[model samples]
Structure formats: C-alpha cells, structure tokens
Target: MTTSKTEGKQCNLVNHDEIWKVHINMELESAKSWPQKWGFLTESYNQAMQESSKVTDRILKLELPEHLRTRPPTPPEEYLETTQAFIGWRSAVPGLQLERYGRVQCGKKSFLKELGWALDGCS
Candidate 1:
C-alpha cells in the first residue's frame, strides 16, 4: 500500500509503507499479437511522476548516453529486403511509448542501484 502526499503532510498506506517496493511486470507484446493494458501500473507510474517534480520534469526527455540507454540501437544489417529482419534485439524490452516520442520505462536495474542513481544525482 501507498499514500499520496498532500499539503506537506505525511500520509501512510492503511497498513503499509508510503514508499513501496513492488514489481510491475509487462509481457513481450509483439507487433503481431493483440495488446493489453496495465491500468494499475499506468496509474502507479503516473502517480510516481506526479509525486516527484524532478521525475515529471525530466521524464519526458531523458537523454541518457548510449551506454545508459536500456537497449542499444539495433545494429545495421544487410538484407535483401526479402525476409523480416530484426537485429540486435537482446532480450525482452518493456516500456510505454509516449504520444509524440520518448518512453517511460520499467527497467532491469536493481532497487538499490536505482535508489542510489536512477532518479536524482545520476552519475
């Protein structure tokens, strides 16, 4: 459980910590298959963004260096334009595509790693 902060007052989840640690999972929804929505996750992510001004501000246009990008760009391939081609896809990549561009991610980094550097003061 989690609580929203309003008017600088500390709030608590009915029986749980205000700050939570949980896994929000997504499947590998390929282009060929139908899609599904994770509404609870969407709401949770939105709430997280709303709670942190710093996250909301930079979340839209995160410009991580190549090494920091969750997935490196697909490698160039030589194709005869005959068969379907996908190169450099290493593993399952889960994220939400934004309206115009960019993404909001559920990542592979450990919680402690994220706690130390994912949000503020990344180095």
Candidate 2:
C-alpha cells in the first residue's frame, strides 16, 4: 500500500508539470507571433492616417476661396450693432417666409416699414 501511494503522488506531480509546460509553450508561441500581429495593426493605422491627411488636404483646398479664409478687417461697432439689431428683429418675427411671393407684392413692404421705424424712430 505505501509503495502504491508514493507512485500515485508522483503521477499527479508529473501530470501537473505537463500542464504547466503546455501553458508555457503556448505563451512562447504567442510572443513569437506578436511581430506579425503588430505589423498588421501598424499597416492599418498608417492607411487610416493617410486617408485622414487626404481628407484634410481636400477640405483646406476647397475652402480657400470662401470669405472666411480672407480674414477681412473688423467692421465698426455701430455697423455691427445695427446688423445685430436687424438680425434680431428678423429672427423675432415668426415664420417669416419670403421665398413664396414676388418681390414687389411680398412681405418686404411690411418688413421695410417696421425696419425703417425701428431705425429712424418714425412710423
């Protein structure tokens, strides 16, 4: 009985050691394959970077002729104030659609009347 117990313990130890060796081998294989995986990831990242650079270049080239790109000098404070007031008044009027009517018969007469009164304090 004692000899058999000793043999059983040795068998268990050998099985455990085999399991540990297999795990270590798998880990080493994964480590060895890392460079290929890293290369694939790096290639994908470089392609994305190139595409983003192309999009940025296209946007900059297309937007170069707009008024925003010219950086004109600032308008006077009085002009800015007047423009803001006109914009505010136009925005306050509800559902003011001007595209549906002729210029002579449209809401422009009413709008101009109110705007003139607001500007010159005369109705």
All candidates' TM-scores?
Answer: 0.16, 0.30
Q: Write the per-residue lDDT of candidate 2 for residues 1-50, one digit (tens) a residue.
A: 22465754435667778999999999999989998777688888999999
After TM-score superposition, the amount by which residue 122's alpha carbon in candidate 1 deviates from its true location, in angstroms, is 51
Reference-based lDDT, residue 83, model 1: 25
Cα-based lDDT for every prediction: 0.48, 0.66
Write one digit per residue (lDDT tens) for candidate 1, span 1-123.
323546556556632432332211122333223324444677778778778977667787878765336533444493333222322232222332123354566788777675675454544
Cα lDDT of candidate 2 equals 0.66
State the local distance difference test value for candidate 1.
0.48
TM-score of candidate 2 relative to the true fold? 0.30
> How many clashes show up per model?
0, 0
